[model samples]
Structures are given as structure tokens and as C-alpha cells.
Target: MGKKYNRVLLKLSGEALLGEQGHGIDADILSTYAQEIKAVQEAGVEVSVVIGGGNIFRGVKGATQGMDRVQGDYMGMLATMINSMALQDALEQIEVQTRLMSAIRMEAIAEPYIRRRAVRHLEKGRVVIFGAGTGNPYFTTDTAGSLRAIEIEADVILKGTRVDGIFDSDPEKNKEAKKFDQITGDEVLKRRLSVMDLTAFTLCRENETPIIVFNMNKKGNLKRIVVDGEPVGTTVIWD
Candidate 1:
């Protein structure tokens, strides 16, 4: 096997947490993720996580419904914190050391996010979950994941999605879509693929952080990528 990435930031969308349910957290899905993360940690990979809040609330959707944009965004952030807390509790149940940090000041629920402290927690083999997005309106959780990955100097971002990898088009909608084994950041931009938002994609590109888009629903995929160095997903890298 080839060398494995030492530290990685795993990005899980809020929708991922909703396994079979159309909305809300599904216990089975949460348990599966916690087990996967624990297996990866046992293999000596430092892990941190950032989860989105679209399952619970979407700021743009709220704005379309005539709600205040900023207020809706804040509510979205709070939703992420809720998801983070759920994830934290699940990981702990599996005996994985975990930390829940929030960008927003919610001292009672989570520790305020501090760059060095987060790194230290990772150093101590604790899985740090970053919640509340960027603590500011208008920035997506994808941006928060990118910012935290850069801050902690992660080797890659393991983007856990429903699909196996990034395709030329949405695989769900287009059965004929083509999948790329490996791709360049520039190509993704030129093709206008929706891997990440432009802001997060640019940040990863400029920083030379590789991103692996894989299906987390597949059991053992996480451990295979982090421990065995298996190319189980499409790797997006700087050319």
C-alpha cells in the first residue's frame, strides 16, 4: 500500500446525516459514521469534521420564503451546531475521543473554536468537530471546512457524499455522466462542476490541498482511504 494521509478534514453534508428519513437525524446513519470514524482513528490518522445544516435549515430557502437573509443564515449556523452535538454524542458512545467546537460563542454547548487548541486536540488523538460554520452570515459550511482545513494544515479533505465520486455531471440526474479517477482543480473550475463552492474550491486549490470525494455510505471506505491509501474516490488536486 502507498503512504496514507496523516491528517484530514472530513466534510459531511447535513443531508448525509439524514439516512432514510427525508429530514432530521437518523440514528442508524449517525452510528455508522461514528464507527467509520473510530476505525480510521484507530489506524492513527488525525481526524476533524465539519458538517453542513441543509437537512435542518437552508438560509437561501428561508430567504426565498421572505425571511431575513442574515437571520436565516444564523439559524442555519445554529442547525449545524445541533448536528455537531449529535455527532459528538455518537462518537463518544463508540469510545472515540471527540471535541465539539463552535465558531459562534456557545460556551455552554461547545468550546469556542481556537486554531491552536483544535490542532492540539487532534494531536492528542481527539476528533474535533467544528460547528456553527464561520460564525458569520453569508458564508457556507463548505467555506468553514476549507478555512479549518487550512488552519490545521490538513493533508486532504475527505468529502463524504452519496455518490462514489465527482462526475462530469450529476450522476443521479444523468445516468450517462462520466466519472473522473483524478482531476485537476483548474479543470473542475473550467467545467463548472459543483464539487465545492467557488470560495472553498479556490482556497483548496491555492493551498494545494487534495480533496477526495467518496461515498461514505459504503462500509470500510473511510478506513481504506486513510489507512490503506486506496484510491477509492476521485481525487481533486492542483495540477
Candidate 2:
């Protein structure tokens, strides 16, 4: 089967890396994600990743505790860098060439984010991981993912979550919540489903970049969606 997308931006929550553990990254989860990513890449999909820092630290949580908002956000950015480095290591271990680019410019560990360089890396079939959350405070990694995806002209944004797809209500809490195989972005906004922050969703809506929310923990699902062109997730469209 032909691939569904030429390039995609994968947005993952840091908490997804926790697995059964309460804190930090689980080695098993990291390995599984790396393998899933490798499968898609090998199938000729240009992939870029943006992972959240919620598992390690959340700036909003810190701010609620009276910490300076900017300082807390910067710390959160560093936490994302930590997760990015781990994923980079895991991908490299599996012989997948990758480049870790940081928005905040930590020269010792990551190269500073440059749009041209990042696109070049993707063109060469290297998976690029974007870290540090837009190099600014007050923006979630979701916003960063949308920004990067549009910048690189990715065909879609693949949000890898624990859930099967977007639902009308919290599927974990509300057993009767309805699931939509496909929905318009306007409906997502009107219903206020938290697929992503408003800023991020608005970016995608304006740019016409489709978003697929799917279960990344399910082995082979990534390949099925990207390579086999299966409808394994809920697709958010602009129309």
C-alpha cells in the first residue's frame, strides 16, 4: 500500500512515557515508541516529533504553587529537552538516524533549531525531534508542534495519545461518550473538546493541516495509519 502522508509531525505527551511507573521515563515504552517510529520512517514517511514535559514537570502546576511563571516555564522546557534526548538515544540505538534540535539553544546537547536545517534533515530521511517548546514561555508543546508542522509543510499532525481517538466527553470517565471517526475543526472548537490548546488548534484550522489522534501504545498502529492508509484514528479536518 502507498503511504498516506509524505511528512508528519508527531505530538506526544510526556506522561505517555511513564508507562506503569509513576514518574520518569520507562525504558520499555521508549523502545516501543522508537520501533514504531522506525517502522513509519522505513516506509518513507518524513517524521518530526514534539513531546511534552508533563511527566517531569509542568510549568502551569509550578505557577499555581507561586513560582514565577517564566522561570517555571523555562524549567519545563528543560524537562522536555531531557525527554527529547532519551528518545533520540532510543531511536539511535535502533539504527534510526535522528537529530535533536532545541528551541532554547543548548549547544552542548542539541543543535539550535533552524528551519532549513530541520527540513534538510527530514529530506535526508532523518527523524527530527523538536524540543524546548517554541523557545518562549506561555506556549504549550502542542502549539510548538503545530508551528513546526506548518513551518515544514507537513501533510498532517499525528497526535499519539493513550486514547483511541477524540470523544465528545472524557472516555475514561464517561463510558457513554461518543466517538467520531472524522470531524470538522469548527465542530471540535464548538464542542470544546480538548484535542489541543486553542492556539495550536487555531493554527491547524487556519493552515488546513489535518490532525490524527490515535493510540500510539498500540503496536503497529503508526505503520498502519501512515503506510497502510488505514483509518486507525479520528481525523480532524478543516471542512
Candidate 2 per-residue C-alpha lDDT over 116-143 given as tens digits, one digit per residue, 9 for 90 to 100 = 9999999999999999999999999999
Superposition TM-score, candidate 1 onto the true structure: 0.96
For model 2 the TM-score comes to: 0.97
Model 1 alpha-carbon miss at residue 65, Å: 1.6
User: What pairs collide in candidate 1?
Assistant: none
Residue 91 displacement in candidate 2 (angstroms): 0.4
Per-prediction TM-score: 0.96, 0.97
lDDT of 1 by residue, 62-172 (tens): 454787889888989999998999999999998999999999998999999999999999999999999999999999999999999999999999999999999999999
> Which consecutive 10 residues in model 1 have the weakest lDDT in total?
58-67
Please list the C-alpha lDDT of all candidates, in the order they appear. Answer: 0.92, 0.94
